[model samples]
Target: MVQVIDGDTMVVMKGEESVNVRLYGIDCPEGNQASGREAWIFASKLADGNPVEVQPIDIDRYGRTVATVHVNGRSINEELIRSGHAWVYTQYCTNDFCRDWLKLQSDSQGARSGLWAAKNPTPPWDFRHSFKLAQATPQSSKPKAPPASAASYHGNISSRIFHDSSCQHYDCKACTATFTTRQQALDAGYRPCKKCGAK
Candidate 1:
């Protein structure tokens, strides 16, 4: 079971037969990135081409076993994420590791390790769609950039921005004006300034 096929998939030998197992509760990036390959390497090292204790929860539509794999008393799913090899997948997670996995992802992201190295790395699911679309259509026109002056201040129209800094990007989109400070932007009913990358 030590050979990694991809970020989230592995091949394990079960009673002399090979079985494909999709790791549960976590999502690694696609194979196109360095982080994706790192994830595969980490999983392979954890599995060590040996029989692991796989507790299958269900069979996914792709017929792969969706399971929590344990090797040497450690949960491979958690190890992959905590070690910065993978990300916790909230959309399809079925285990208690979901929250912990998310925390691990956050920690990795904060450290700018693996996938976090990219300025904006695409999620695996989203990357899949983008890949399909790319295959269907050849690269052509460049996307048009938004106008710098296309912005408006919110004033009293929106008060919620004052409390939540996350709304900055949305406010920047609506106002078309970037702000120097989050507080100033929020006071103007413009959320955080996206152009300045206020976050």
Candidate 2:
């Protein structure tokens, strides 16, 4: 029997070996290293320290069993999202409820609740990659810039065919007025210039 731990990792009591089970179809915030404590608290409440059935769908490279846990005949994964504690792992989720989970996450983000309260929260997978990179490299190192040729030009200015700076992607000649900031123009409901569209 394994007890649900967090969104991703779990603890299974298997005789002497304590198996760490990783749940599928959900990517909870990192509990230990990055908001891991909060994640753990959320997961514990969801699991309530009870024994859960670990239905394995696959085994991850780390030998952790990837499973969809069911407790009291309810989908723990769905509960996590509905409670605004976890997000659907879009990269790996195959369940039909994935769309619903995504919607739940969107709603939470719009409401600025739970994990969404963090400013510019990174996805768990991306956070792991960045953590590894930081551990392997020095922070003082500067990143290389892209080549100048990689830059793209809009178009040649002529015959009053200029892109509205407000809407760079739209070439609207009717609204050629450029504002100091794009937000200002967008607030006025002005579309891109018809002649030269800017994005």
Candidate 3:
């Protein structure tokens, strides 16, 4: 692998191309979330710069290659769950192995491993949703723009994603729609910018 982006995401050298791979059937905490750094360190030690096997599963909405990765004949995806560094992503895990993975997750939770050490740790999906809700607060009751350049929220019409000023893509080529508040973008059916975690 060329780089371990996080606990469950990596950039691997697939032939001459660098492919972004999302580990299948499991979800790890985001880098900024609880137990996130520990999970990342463990995954990096297990997989980074190692010649590993990638078992292709499916492509995700973000265009990432979803796969099960193996290092030294051991499955990294399964290892993460076994170590309590990840949770079984039941929403997308349709394969038969998901049942076994869920059992492992339960065992980890019962043992208070990793993020489960917290009495009630927030799931990554729920964390993301809460973050969006927090950011969705309207700047003002009425919608009005001071100026085009001063707009706080920017939307990419093509991708249907909105970015805040903090994002590098806030003023990207496709970001023609401008909003005074994040709620305006959300009301228009635009999803938050994943990179900046903008709502």
Candidate 4:
């Protein structure tokens, strides 16, 4: 693997190409969410610099490859759940193997491991939904400065999405394009990030 981007995403070399793989059946905390750093550290320890096996499952809306990664025959997706670093992501975990992962999640929760240690840990999906809502809310009516000259926005050429600096995905590998303002990105046919409210 080239590097571990977050708790559940990593860049792996496929021939001469680098593919972004989102671990299947699990959802980790976002970079700004609770236990997010710890989850990334754990995943980094397990996968970074280690050769892994990727079993492709599907392609996500963001153009990420959803797959189960294995290291030394151990499933990293399952390990994340067992270690309490991620949730079962039941929305897409329809296979029978998900049952075992669900059990692991329950056990982790019962043990109060990792993020489960929180009094009421927020799921990543719920946190993302809240972020989206907060982003949608109107801002101050005060006059804002004109669009800055510096390129402060990152655009994902493939996904056609743009993200500001505040976004965890602002430096995503696919975000090779840059824009001086949100309007520039919009005019260039890019949309705001759903996670960070880049608009």
lDDT of each: 0.61, 0.57, 0.77, 0.80
State residue 160's C-alpha deviation in candidate 3, in Å. 20
Candidate with best lDDT: 4
TM-score attained by model 4: 0.74
Q: Tens-digit lDDT track for model 4 on 19-129?
A: 878889899987557787688779888986778999999998767899999998999999999998999999999989999999999999999999999999899899768
Cα-based TM-score, every candidate: 0.64, 0.60, 0.72, 0.74
Q: What RMSD does model 1 have?
A: 18.5
- Mark the regions of model 3 whose C-alpha exceeds 4 Å error after superposition: 140-165, 168-199
Provide the clashing-pair count of each candidate structure.
7, 18, 0, 0
Model with the higher lDDT, candidate 1 or 3: 3
> Which 10 successive residues of model 4 have the least lDDT summed?
142-151
Candidate 3 C-alpha lDDT tens digits along 11-127: 788788777678999888765567766787788899866898999999876667899999999999999998899989999899998999999999998988888889888787786
- Tens-place lDDT per residue, model 1, 23-114, is 89888875454466577667777877566898898877656788888988898888877777777788889566587778878888898877
Model 4 stretches with alpha carbons more than 4 Å out: 142-199
Extract clashing residue pairs from model 4.
none
TM value for model 2: 0.60
| Candidate 1 TM-score, true structure as reference | 0.64
